[model samples]
Target: MATPSARASCPLLLLPSPPPACPSILATKRTQRRRRILSCRAAVRFDRRDVLAGLTGVAAGELGAHPGLAAAEDASVVSCPRGETVTDKLLACQEAGQKPCPPTPAATAAAVDFTPPTSPMRVRQPAHLADAETVKKYRQALAAMRALPDSDPRSFASQAAIHQAYCDGHYRYGGPAAASKDDAPFDVHFSWIFAPWHRMYIYFYERILGGLIGDDAFALPYWNWDAPAGMAMPAIFKDAGSPLYDANRDPAHLGAYVNLDILNTGDTVIPFDPQAVQNNQVVQNNLCTLYVQMMRNKKAQDFLGDKFCAEYPSTVSSGTSGSLESMAHTSVHIWAGDPGSSTVGNDGQEHTGADMGFLGTAGRDPVFYSHHANVDRLWHLWATKLGRSNFDDPEWLDTSFVFYDEKPQLVRVRVRDVLDAAALRYSYDDREPLRWMDARPTPLLPKGTAAATTRRSLLRGAAPAPAFPLTLTPGQSVEVPSVPMPPRAQKTPAAGGGTQPDTVLVFDRIEFEPGRSGKFDVVINVPPEQAAAAGPRYSEYAGSFATLPRGGNRSGETAVVALVLPLDEVLADIGVGDEDGAVNVVIVPRTQGIKIIRPPRIEIRER
Candidate 1:
């Protein structure tokens, strides 16, 4: 067993050529001397089963060439060295303030409490208005902040500068007295570098955000990416025709291309399989290569990008798929690598890189959570589509992590605790959400509508209306004439047809404005017969709002919502579930004269 330190350094040095076969007595003496060296650091533990297993795989001729060694094989023990070199390195890491080791195997065997305490509902100040004007103001503020000197620790850029300073400060790895063996070449076991490094880096950035926007009221808005339209670079990210903004590369290019290089080593340019958008293996390799490059180059932006525009998952998952796990996993996994290939720190001392282990580099990337957000959303969608909920896996919950606090205090985090998005205190809105696995439908809106919908509404408090209206204007109300239901299909034993109790919620359009939001009131008069069962249930809500021609679905036969709202309110609403866990709503957003965009439903279960 090679000690971790023995393997953390550069690859094995070129060995000297050995002399021709020596006299048996002399050879025996030399072997004994080498064995003494090996025994000091490592002890051989032999088991009959392993020796027998190896012998069985050998050919008769090969076995005959070394009959004595073979005869002793069943009872012979192979070298299992515990390179003291690793122990010495661990000591050095400790002296230099690296993360402390886990208390001992016995001490850690007990289960840890990873359950997150109930989260207090946050009464956050409303989002800062993001109209063109506000966006401009925010950008200006950011620029001013970035322009400050690094010594002015009051600014975020300054705080980040501190980390850069410390990278060459007391945190430096390896010392003069460090053993040569501990400075061996790199391999997979160096992933430990990523976890600690990123943890520190993100903390610095987060503090910067807290400093920029008052921490109490600020929340970073993600780019709604579930919709293809939102996937493009928003005007907000550009300096307007500046060479920095490549419209084609805005939404996916920066992160994807950089990550592709990290994991796949600047592999193919075009898609691996033209028919398949992102093949999994290609994605994995792409991420691995990208991280390795980052580690080798000592360039974090090489992977994370230099500007806020490139910050990830900050862009929302507005695409049709409604899932981002595969991409996220590729991102985290590559930051570390599969066991080890490249991507190790070059300190020639402490092991650093994903090669150190999965928890090393992968856990360090601030992108990990953003990546997991997509994974979590995918699971949510899977539950809805497959009629299931909750990923109740013991194995998942059992995964453990040791994170360093600001004081470098080691704290443990578990996978189960991360399952809830609210617990994480972040929310992502998916703009396109209509997904049925293989069905990639055309957008309900016409050409130019997607981009048009992205525009902020002139009316302050209402959902933007394209060519159709989903709500009434302020102080206006119109009665929606009730329509009779169509006759049901005749059920027969031969046809195997039976009624599927309707769990769908039908609504007129929902409306909202910045200050004055619209509300749709419905009288749920529960029937006496079903009242006993009308309690909380986990239900999937689905609905769609379409902007058809003026006369289309005029008979009131279509199940769509068309409402209007005043200019100063916010979009705030609640949903209820039905008996036996059944409820689904689909919403489409459109106004009479404007082209319409289909919106995905917001799923809710009675709380």
Candidate 2:
């Protein structure tokens, strides 16, 4: 079996010849914009499985026979006026434009020497808690980064490029031939790799920022969006004259408190009154979300996500995203970015753009690092406080990604090396234990406690009602009839002294239209008028359906996705399972700026 490094080194050899005539970089501005939009759309269409299997081994004989295809594939070898060589068609696309396109930076080079950090730095606190000195250091570092020319590797543009390369599949596999296969874009999201990948990304970014200010002890402050006091955009980052501030953000959200719920819609653009009553409610709900995502998800697959396999015969997944990444992580990204900003030409069409909204451009904003810092801190809490363990799979442990070091040299890092933050020489400032865990309402009977009746007296009950489908269109909602608990979930003494069975509400065969950014919130037992009140709070809220951008395939073939939510906690919170035995589910479309042409179908299953 070939090692990952060995396989990655020669991706071009495994691909087909490049296509003819790259899109001219010098094309009219209107044409360039159109091509960019089209290219991004096309890029999302190809499935990861097909990209890994079918595209890697196209027969060279077929290409050799077609002389034009062979020539086009070999065009990367043609030298440009500058001392740079075109590596592939994608590079050609980039080169054709007015800008100079350098070869994609590699993890290792013959001329560069790389070394990992040896000393450790104290972890920084949340932005609100950071003292004057720490804030000054952070601000100065960012200002210095802003001062650097775009050409420098440590500059903001190049750093953002590194992220885009991984997320958007800018780097081809094998060699020049790899350039022809534009469909095979490499993506780090929607997999077990999401947490670790982001951790590594922010670690280096923090290091670079520290280096810029000549403070090896400097640490990046987290946004701390989970707490009420820290919920608003950090004051330090909001100053217009500050280098950390971006003009592209939604002006309304500059100092507004963040709503952990209502994430699918661009909350930044929505009017926020910040009533004390609502603010307090959102804070409690945010804590519950954190508990559910971090502590309630016990299994590795539930928290860290499904495994990622990039080799042949191993199909890639949008993978089942863990609760944290899907909810809080995804929500924060949408919340921080401007929904109305027109960085990309979605004019007339409703959609958010610029730094935080889109995947490709997210890294450009300085807040992205702070946002990810909080995410990393949560991961740390899960591991240390919740006793969660990292995946032991070799594929996960051995997977390597390239990142630039403070030395500004590209270094190859493995997932295993980054599993511990202390080893990386940084730790977060000490904080108190989560108070939310204690705030949860006590269960009727302690879990695993036996009922008063014997096994013979406590008989299994009837089956639940037939599963029903609910369809939701853009800005529309539908409520399904209440679903009853399965007989197995009823309270009973264990046959062999086992723990009480846990019940779950499974949304099976959930399907969404391809190429749309529409999402829906799942609220349980909430009346139509009160649906708006349901969110990260307790029983009233369930979960959400936020599909990632389908890789450029707009074939309209919707993939069936399922959401498995634990019902016990929600039941306990609502104080209802014993009395009502059934709960109504409401599905509300979160579409505000974007349109979902095809309606989504959701089927509820009780287990």
Candidate 3:
């Protein structure tokens, strides 16, 4: 039998060949702006079942009359927590003659009773590498949790309800208006709380599972989608008789290569041939995306997301999604979810997404936990492997939320407690390589343009950048003409020589159709003609903002959110000097119908 690391190592996943980048941006050909630049099909020839072995108890009979794990919630009893969401909603209530929600508790009220454990750590193995026994243990734990009645806090359904409540706030005043996740008990998605909140959510979940199965050492296996062999939905979760399976996923996507950067093209773009030479770009493209996201955005604000204290969840959020939440994290959610199926939402109307896609019901799927485990593991890697430190803000460090522990007692945990996973007595198996580390993609020059193209002439003679209220052309890459870049400010050396402030591409607001998931890339200084064809494994690529479509049948709704991309690294690589007066901002939409209804500006943020 092969070791865990040995099982993960495969010779076929490497790139065939690729090259070049410039200080002057280059882009690839874009015949169809709406079509995917490169959709990947990464396949492992071995039978995955041969890799996954198990022993398990018979799955308990289905509960709640629903065919699968609905873990449904009642819309009436949900309340929006105060001091945790946007101030706009509160003002609206005051204007409407309604009293505001109560004030948020101060930092003193936050839980400080907890301390890191002194016990040895339990390691979470990657899903594809774990032996059959480990997989079986995971299933048996879920089966035990699933058997409990919804009334029990530790029951599977109740756990889902807790996640939905904290995900965002939804409500009704007993009127004809429909309920939406516009406000929140706690808005965890776009804020700095994202990683820590999810870590606690899953920590309690794992503890309960361990308690149920009489094994304190039991740790959840991550989906490990970052690695090629583990890209598809894990085989264990697909079994019909297992507690892990959910019927709401895309049937066509079962056992297929994961699409790391999918457009709203639906199932139209998932390639069936993993060996096809054309599909190789996607595998490489996603790896580079990881590199760009983790390496490019070194600041706590860019990587962890904006500070989201007292903000509500609506189409327009005060804070923006961070590098981790918006890019591949969101893409995986939209990819794994079944958009084709319509199920009843809290509003009692039919809506899209189940299990993995939407925020409200994602926790109902067993795969959601495993998926988040990988996300948490990535955060761990970002801090430990990359040597990045979190924010020094007292608010972020002291932020706390409540959860039910394995002992069935409601416990409050602080963000400070979860920063060290080892202190919490758990760690991820680092044996599998971080393959994306090597994905420093070379740039592609625009067609008809020679490598000898004069950089100074293009930099100095470029047309003035187009102004705001610029209506973007649908299904086309929109390039704002060269905009002036403020020269770099002199740096005062900080202690230990930490990261300097970042140069960024900041958008004031991006208005788009709500309730639909989409993607658009921000390629700094890339020629518009080549932006689309120049896949992520290229130097011009900066980052992307992806949506995790909301539930509900509501259509014709629009959402306005802000976006930011780090440009210091890409510009420096292309040889764009700090003294360079301007840079081109290209908007490459991966899906049609997306519109940028506002202007974008370039600025520098000091952390």
Candidate 4:
């Protein structure tokens, strides 16, 4: 919708001639009529392509396959030349009872101002942000409520009431541009980015808690899944203050829905199963599409209510398990800006179109995080099943992200920072891991099947790993792909084991020439059955990374490092099955003259 300032100046800029006899009354009448007619037209045919035509005063027919005007052109009553003179024709027609062309602004500034522009950095406060007293009261109510049984459904029911009350107090109409503004429309959906958004959102809730409980000591806990004890649903999720709290969930229903077989499939175990990786990608894309639709929502009540959440009944879950694999509700995380080359586009280009800010549009409602915590929790669970040392993978050691700390300070966090319960500086003693309950006594299969398929499929197929193999040089990186692992049946490197366990595989190891810099990338492929098996057996080449010096950024000498050793036969000890599996490793370098960060262990599972 056009802003008031834009509308107010429309007469001055578009109507360059002196005002007509009934100009004031005519302006108001035209404004109302246009709103009644054009707003409806705008709703159906809106796209980025039409923004230029809307601003340039071009004929709507000349929109030239621009998606933005499709709906509007289809609905327009009088199809005429939409030029700079059109506005005058329109006004003249309103008075003369003959259809006239809509006039375009004589001055560029007026047309530019009235264009349906995107809000790059607009921040609209949710109603809950108001009322210092209500936030204070609610915090106190939450502390008292914490003492209630964590397992009891009533706990979440009560907390949900508090959430509902707060939501009721502060909510308002988000506006019409809610739809298609961002890649995500505002509705309930959950995924990895969910927890991050909620962490920020719940900070407000915690501040309210601090005020009411009279203790600034109150810190909301993340459902810790680094270990089994930290994996259960926390009291906060079940607490009565949570708008999303569900207390009356049936255990039998949960048992039927939350199958361990589907939940524990770690990406590492399968590495890069092409099909599984594709499927995961599909899920993410579908979600982004759905989220974009939700942003079109005009009413906050429909968003806050369960109506939107119920759309994906199969995905949403009541417990932590159900939430992770998929959410019956909407939880999303919107990365709302351009992130440069790191972004992968729908067209698979280096930089084709707007990709990042798609998530923060007005259409996306705020409940995206609660849904993602569940998905993130599931990822933690998958990591555990791989091995406690799974986090020790050199690939994860230096992974970094920017987030606001408790002191409201911006800081970079490594995955290692959250590895230990104490180091993470939080606890989730109340929520238990899936292991706390009975494990399936037999290999669980889908409905009506007694035995499962022995021909296991790939879980996460190999693309390349993200680690960069720095050259001995300090500031370079490149991609590395390890040579294919020989079949396990053939005797190679270290007697019984295919590759030496202690040797690290540099997927993207770069070789430097005399006084010069160079780089390359390695790729790895992991099979499905082996990924599910989870033991350190078969090894696939993962990807490699490398970088180079600023001035000497060019390809140089390269070599391969192959080591074979016996990995610790601790798979059975960690609840992993000893089975055949494969992983392909690759390395990619950003530039040259940089050292490639290498993996700590070597490969053995080869024929």
Best-performing candidate as measured by lDDT: 3
* Cα deviation of 79, candidate 4, in Å: 55
**lDDT for each residue of candidate 2 in 32-112, tens digit (9 for 90 to 100):** 111211101000111222212211123223222222122223422111111111122222223222222223322133223
Whole-model lDDT values for every prediction: 0.24, 0.51, 0.57, 0.24
Ranking by TM-score: 3, 2, 1, 4
lDDT of 4: 0.24
Measured over all alpha carbons after superposition, the RMSD of each candidate to the real structure, in angstroms, is 27.5, 14.1, 18.7, 25.7
- TM-score winner among the candidates? 3
Q: TM-score for all predictions?
A: 0.29, 0.67, 0.74, 0.26
Which model, 3 or 4, shows the larger TM-score?
Answer: 3
For model 4, residues 509-589, the per-residue Cα lDDT tens digits are 113321111223222222222323221111221212211111101123222211111222221122222132222232333
Ranking by lDDT: 3, 2, 1, 4
Which stretches in model 1 have alpha-carbon errors above 4 Å? 1-211, 223-227, 230-235, 240-418, 434-607
Ten residues in a row with the worst lDDT in model 2?
A: 7-16
Please report how far candidate 2 places residue 27 from its true position, in Å: 28
- Candidate 3 residues 1-607, lDDT tens each? 1111110000000000111211101112213222111000101011112111100111112111211111111111111121122211121111111111111223113323555555457789988788787898989999999998665667787777555544423311111111232221224565566777788888888888888998888889999888766777888888898999998797778867777776522344444453452337557767887887777777666777765533233222324567877877887887788877765543244557676777667878888899989988887778778877776555556555555666665565667667777778898887767888888867665421321232343433444444444455535777764444545553334678855755677664566543456678777666677777655677777778777655322334344556777777776666666444455677877764455544454555555
Number of backbone-clashing residue pairs for each candidate, in the order shown: 94, 18, 13, 158
